[model samples]
Target chain A: MKSLLKKKCHRAGLIVVFAIAVFLGPAHGYAKAETAEAKSECITCHTDVKKLIRLGWKIEKTRPKPGKSAETAGKG
Target chain B: MEPYEKIYVKPSFLKTNHGKIGCEVCHNGDTKDPDWQTAHKGIIKDPTFPDADKTCGECHEDITSTAKNSLHYTLAPFGGVIKARANKKDKRVFEKVCQAKEKHCSACHSSCGQCHVSRPDYVAGGFLAGHLFQEKPCMDTTCASCHGGRVYAEFTGANDEYPADVHHDKEEMTCMDCHTGKEMHADATGVASRFDLPERPRCEKCHPDVVSKKPKTSSHAIHRNKVACQVCHAVANKNCFNCHAGTDKKGLPYFKSNETRMLFKIGLNPNKTKDRPYNYVVLRHPPADPRLFDFYIKDGLSDFNKLPTWKLDTPHNIQRITPQNKTCNNCHGNVSLFLQKNDVTDWEQKANAGVVVPQAKIPKPLKEISPKWKP
Candidate 1:
């Protein structure tokens, strides 16, 4: 019980610090940087779809049952 | 998902109009650092949530303003039902229950980005298509991701015992074909249930001729206003049992439910109206129980009997030849097919009293019948 309470407190502390950081004002970044090109390095590392699927990024191709016991479907 | 999939951005997205806005504007994160956590210190994970009046709202003001109240975004109807059953007299306990509702139930609610850009957070969100803004969210991927447990699964005939809905099998009609963009993006000002919406999807909306004065079939003439279409057409509909909610050791919430499939039941119409004048309707037991909020506050829903347990349902497994349509005797004399008084326990007996069909109320079998309704 004490350990669970401590973990909750630790999470609460992090949330408070994060909230303060947000209130302090915008940090140094390209929030309003204008360029001829969008210049997104985000796509640099995130475009590999096949790897994501292999790593369990569920992109269900077919309609699969939500659970095991749900049945082949009803007596339709 | 791998860390990359959670943050996957398509190269093609960067070329689109939305992508041209740059991630910094929407995310409000640092571009100087490459460290994922450090750079995303103050990131707005979903800029189009709660209300998108600032980011995407700059471009699409009208939709962003109204979509906030959409059932997909708010899921407020769930709360409405809870509130109806709750003992609002105890303000302190009621307030605590509301927080529990937010922690567990509302955790699965959606936003624009979750639909068009990525999977829902509850499903361990990842980009849907390299962050490319889709005009229509994929039926299987986006819609089914949330509704997979019931509607999407039953409609497409994922249930091995039942064939697919006639519309899905014959006409290849998808959810968007009937649901429409207008209803989904509608202004839900004072709506508690989907049926409360003025422009909800109706079977009559598409099949007008079947409801004509001089109907082609005798079955339609007899049961048109008296019975719901699902009473005759729906296959074994899925019915869920007691669902309980609790927080794990890590303080994240989850739900556990017991359900049964291929069970078709008929009961008194819970919510009848001019649009749906059916006296008898299909009833599906939603996985809601009094102990659902016990994890937060014991017996929070003190007045649980305020609403019926077996609520009205429009099951998706519509077929041309349902067991009920086999003959009049298939439904009339089959007391087992109806939701009887003994189906529910004594505690739930009060909650489901209106829906449970009495032994005397079950219809008697006729001598002859025909499968006349083909439309």
Candidate 2:
């Protein structure tokens, strides 16, 4: 029974390690430098996300402002 | 040679009379100078060199006003840079997605020289001429460069398919046809403009016939007591199922199954219901038989054998007639009125059975042809 418990514990530990390696390891090195450089360049040129949306463009993780927001700003 | 002859004698007189200026003062003259041609060429080339907003400004200052207000200029530098970066990122993603078979960045992104210079020859004159004149950048070689053969073909088809009244069909219009300058919210460098504004020539340009058919005959007319045209026609076609039909490759007839049509009728309703006070369906059919289909109420279902099937007489006009109210319960609050009206028993049995049903035929799809009725 003790041997079986040790075996199960070893399998659980292996599963945990495998999960971390599969998920975290690849994400860490996934074009980090290139992505950062490209994003920075985009921000440099476009200045803000709102402009991109107005041009019918979209980037991941950017929330579009309400349609009225732009009109209101124009009035100002 | 006399001193007067040296100063005033013409070239013809040089051989006959005393030589002029000793041939060296003005000409720096070796009578047959070897390097003189090279010196003169350099001066001509220097003046002709192209410089945006400056070289072209010499001839066309007014041209700059249109461009400054144009989306291309408004979103320059910053918008362009962001687009370039995004293009690079997209290229990487495309390379991965297409397994490197397809290239993406160059397809959509115009190169630095492509927009700034002209083709067939990349001389200073070419660059200057392009900037001075209001010509579309080279779409054939530059735009088609990385866009692949399929996209090039589609663009050609789209150009051919565009209606004559469409702004793009007008002389010298371009990809910026619908995407007007005022619509451009982003600065050239990719920053949002200080003001975000709705573009003009909105919806009404293409659908002028529908919007302005009659003074009181519009979808807005039905709910004018409640809503406005901007409330519904604000977005492209306002989610009308028919207008957006065959838009998606998957939903298109090429991939659609018979079962799929039975399960969920695609393109039947171009105008989908939205967050308005009352839900309405906009039915559109060719105006050839204008009197046949009624504009108001749900009288069209009587013409069709099934809910959406109509027989077509001519292949050219495959008219799609959608009724105003689709969901019977939406407005009526019950199905009893719908069943009573649409019932075959309500009419004389033989007349009901022999009702001439309209059919759909497509001689050609939404392709531009010689106008049936001259404008």
Candidate 3:
């Protein structure tokens, strides 16, 4: 009788665990799937929106002033 | 930014979950080919438009299905008003009228991107913050872009001499505060008109005790049962009298109209029901003619009396204390502000039926005031 009761309790525990897994498992998986699918190569180069502006400004910084020519830039 | 520069300056769709997919998934341009012409061939400008299933529906299936049936997309309310006025039982003729209007009037639809990412197409949408996906829609920028050209102007005091709505001016309440996403994505139940929707927002829903809280005078207690909140609160608003639509020489559709009158008037309710069973409600002349699309349809909207031309309008410009609230004479004695036989023309008398107050129904003045009215 004791052994039979222990077996029944074990079965009930398993059923409860399985039910929780069945209910909560997909929701967790779905959230992960959402994030995983969101990663892309577009972020690699275009992560920063100010890339174009920064590039233009950087080039201007490197370029010689209006009065100074490319040859005379470093000397000046 | 300059109009031409908007394309390049717009940022890539990188931050959003949508960035996970390759550009080719939504845009049909050839990114592999080196040649500009060949690569750019058949590029789809708006992919999530008309049918959001290809893009937004992949994730937001629950919302997209119902959103498709939403009045904002289906424009069934606009169609309902038009159909009611049409009085045409012939399914064939009604279908033709709907098709013709779809070409012209149906251009103002809110697509997925129009709300979630950029401005509406009507306002010449460019990317909001360089193609960044917006989690929260900006009321001033996004919602007002399309609606602002009229309602927002009145609500926010953008129009000259018009005071802002108390809800906006005092509470600083935005549209999103009252209009929720659940209401916006009203499950695809295929409601014919917005007025028919059970979940349509009402003032009493929020302020349940407004009527219980008695005012200083008996006017509120007396008229509270018969008058709508807008009739007492809303100030004079712009009403476009007549709108004549036609295609230009270049085939682009254009709408020209008669003068817009700024006036306040009380009229009979067009759509009277248990919910709005009031005898007197605020009136507005919507710029819809039975012959609006006659240019396209041979005899479009020939029967106009099917729906009242003077519609029961809920103007956005509401105030706690209006000119009408100051004295009983302001409203009770005023005939010019009442929708009567004299207000409508002979031709429009039929279309304005159920909207004009009969002489017998007009409220009699309690006292006579001196003629010192301001223009």
Model 2, span B96-199: residue lDDT tens: 32221112111222222234332212111233231222235545544444432222333343323322222222344444454443343222333332222234
Residue pairs with colliding backbones in model 3 are: B11-B130, B85-B307
Kindly list the per-residue Cα lDDT of model 3 for residues B1-375, writing each as its tens digit.
Answer: 433223332334543567546666876776555443476589776777778887788888988888777766667777666666553777777787777677667877787787877777766676665666776788888888877756787888887888988889999988777677767768535565565676677887776655566643455556765888888889987777566566666556666566677778889877778888777899877676666777666566867776777777788888978988677777786787689888887878887877889877777887654344321
Could you list the chain B TM-scores for each candidate? 0.94, 0.28, 0.87
Best candidate, TM-score: 1
The residue-by-residue lDDT of candidate 2 on A1-76, one tens digit each, is 9999999999999999999999988687776844643333222222333443443333223544222211111100
Off by over 4 Å in 2: A1-76, B1-51, B65-70, B73-201, B205-375
What is candidate 1's lDDT per residue for B1-375, written digit by digit as tens? Answer: 455566667667777898777677888877656554576688888888877788767887788787777888888788898898887898999998898888777877888888888888767677788788888888888888788878888899998788889999999988888887778777777787887787678887888856888777777777889999899999877777777777766555566766664577899887778877888899887787898888789889998999998888888878878888877788888998889888887889998888888878788888876465444
Candidate 2 docks with a DockQ of 0.00
Each candidate's number of clashing pairs is 4, 35, 2
- Top DockQ model: 1
Cα lDDT tens digits, model 1, A1-76, are: 9999999999999999999878754642334442323344344335555654543334343433243222222211
Candidate 1: which stretches are off by over 4 Å? A1-40, A43-76, B259-261, B369-375
